[model samples]
Target: MTDAPDQIPEPEEGAAADSAEHPESLGDDGEFGGVEEFDADARDAADAVYAALLERVGEGAPRPRLEPTRRAVELLGDPHRSAPVIHLTGTNGKTSTSRMIESLLRASGLRTGLLTSPHLERFTERIRIDGESVRDEVLARNWEEIEPFIAIVDAELEGAGESPLTFFETFTVLAFACFADAPVDVMVLEVGMGGEWDSTNVADGQVAVITPIDLDHQSRLGNDVVEIARTKSGIIKPSASVVSARQQDDVLKVLENAADLTESTLAVEDDAFAVISTTVAVGGQLVSIRGLAGSYHDIALPLFGSHQAQNAAVAVAAVEAFIGSGSVRLADEVVETGLGAVTSPGRLQIVGSGPTVIVDAAHNPHGAGSLVASLGEAFDFDEVVIVLGVLADKDATGIVDVLAGLDARFIVTNPGSDRAADTDRVAGIVATRVGADRVTVIERLDDALDEARDWATEGEKRAVVVTGSVVLVGDAIAIAADRGWNAR
Candidate 1:
């Protein structure tokens, strides 16, 4: 995360294999781990910087509020100017897609940087340079260094009487400082929310990546696909190229039109680049991509679900277009390594062997459909025990119906969050659709998970799939870590 801001080479299996293949590069002067060495405990600076950032957030231009972003950048001498980046935006698959790109780039023998969001475990997960998370010590040092200037910005903003910067906004500035200081070769950025006003949009990316556009944050982005796509497409720069995954024609047209208006090159799946072949494999998915400008053969991505195949196509297309822009040339080995090395938690992530455990962030109908489709092709479970929690904004019934076909027993729980969906409300939906006897509403997530585990019948291995809200799955991941549930 921007908080740690240390250079790190992603600890990818492919990269490790590459080193083993060429042992000569494993020396002291050879390709180093992205992050050298640092303490992870020192978030004091991030806390301090965040405190200072909170003060000047609301005032007008030139004030410390939102404008301190620019002031801080200026203070840092505009470090982002030095690094070329590929920024990812969309409703779903941003984090997975970005990580895939980072691994791919690292396989090419070039240093890589990964900047994602909504970290499941730690804040440092957001800003990773080379391969390791930025050290917390570095973050604290920057906060201390920036304090006096932050105070100046706060004073100026207070004089102007403007609203303060939001939490996400201040974090955006801190991320830039972390990345700039790391001096990464290239950065993979995933947007926080709507692309237009999102902090990541401030950077002029070398390429803009748009994943499957859908409706999620209707309160901010919009109520429909077109309006939502419009906001997410804001990350596209005038001089940069744009890469998009498969989309409904109307939504695709909006992005295509935007690219045309900006005089930027546009490539869409099935139009420029596409997934030529896909199949469920012994381990994961076997995929093929036809890049608009080139073609990639069978790329083995060990991530289950059909959605992952699509995400892989987009990542490949992005790297192709990014390199085709006459800047970087991604080697075939690099592309293969990247696709094979990616891992996104709770997105059909399977944990344990006895009675398998799979977790996904399928908070809406669209994502739920993909999860179901992926599970249908990948496993043979006689009974599906679903540990789910949804947010207030999600379509709980719609999502429930999407996975209703399976031999499912619903265990609903609410992680302690203001926006978490009520377990009783969700149980009602399950009761009406499936049956009252099959539904159990449990308030505590840990209790619900235990209930799901208990539902496993002997001789017929029952798997637990934790889904619904990110907050729910995030908590599940945390619990899994605490109890050693992840190792299985």
Candidate 2:
């Protein structure tokens, strides 16, 4: 990995220089210059940035290589190296765990930059600084400064008869550049895909966190848990501290091997740390965590699910490893304040009341199972109407089978992505698993959610749950806000 430069390089001649000199045009202090009129202009510029990124290969089609991103960052003065990174990778819980780690670091009086994938709402949500989304002007300005360098790399790749940078590759460069421009004290990065060659892996992580490795993404990573585990273990850098959730024995063996090869110290859940107890509470739960250095008691985590409790344990261990190298115990107040303020949007998030609409981005069987378990433990609904949608590439059958165990009525719909699975196809799978009487198909997401919520409102102790895909959960959240579902 490249070492961080002693200082951020001055803007080079040409586009970079032009961008640097136009700070007022972008905004003052990365705000819209306090001019109500400039808000539209700032938003337009940010939209243009997303449009330009969408022109490349989409994130679903990730290129399993890093040199392209490495070269781009190298040209941009290696922005990714400007701060220490706590990198996380796995099938699920990566985003949630990354947020917790970032919060803990920020609470400890460090400015932090965070990068997570496939944002539920705006693309800007993927990159956060000090617990908030990076401002529109900042995102646009960084893209403008780096666009010229990206073009240079695109031309070079074409001349060599190779594909240009993919969407994730270019975005990885942008996120790193933004964080370095902010000059954050630390970074918590979530890998976009399998870790070995994911664009984010271009930066070496001081702490490598592996959430539970599972069988999702079989087409790209591997067809089994062990193969996927090996691919996910790629983030374990030489002599780095590795923290992982409890895994299948075979998966643990894979992580152990990776840590041994890298000469990194490996800590596993239930071994180095664990969730000792969890009590369901208002808005979320309280848990005791056996951390690497010490035990944390009755920590308030405002997220549901035992899986989330496990994720909290992993996050605590990760922060312990990063801040004190697993030697210094964090203050109890830091742990309480950090975790208390943590939020995992679209992961068992409550968007509405009355009929009680909820949204969870659980697209795979493992995530679906977690949703089922969390639902069972966290809510006492006599009836449930689940608004389900999934992407074409996901395991619709397995997901349906798992959710069927919840014994809830299902409304299948498209998640409004180009890759969304057909409503009829997913409905057929759901019907086969849970019987036709329990299944309904609604092509439009808004209509599906309306039907589910209306049905839920008819009975006492009934609720609506929107799950199956992140895009659908995002759509539901927006719809809930627009229709004032949460107000009811």
lDDT tens readout by residue for model 2, 70-145: 9999999999999999999999899989988987897798989999988887888888876667777788999999
Q: Taking the candidates one at a time, how many backbone clashes does each contain? A: 32, 0
Regions more than 4 Å wrong, model 2 = 1-38
Assess each prediction's global lDDT (C-alpha) against the native: 0.72, 0.87
Off by over 4 Å in 1: 1-68, 326-329, 457-459, 486-488
| Candidate 2 similarity to native, TM-score | 0.93
Q: Residues 1-488, candidate 1, lDDT per residue (tens digit)?
A: 01122222343543433221121222234234432333334455555554655455321122212255566566667765668889999878888888778877776655776778775555666766665555556566755665565556556656788444455656666677667676678888898887876767778888999999887777777889999999888888887889888888989999988898888988878877778877666557667777655666767777787788788888877887776662344566777777866667668877655667788988888899889988877777878889888888788988999878775988888956677777888899988888999889889989888878777745486789999887778778777767776443
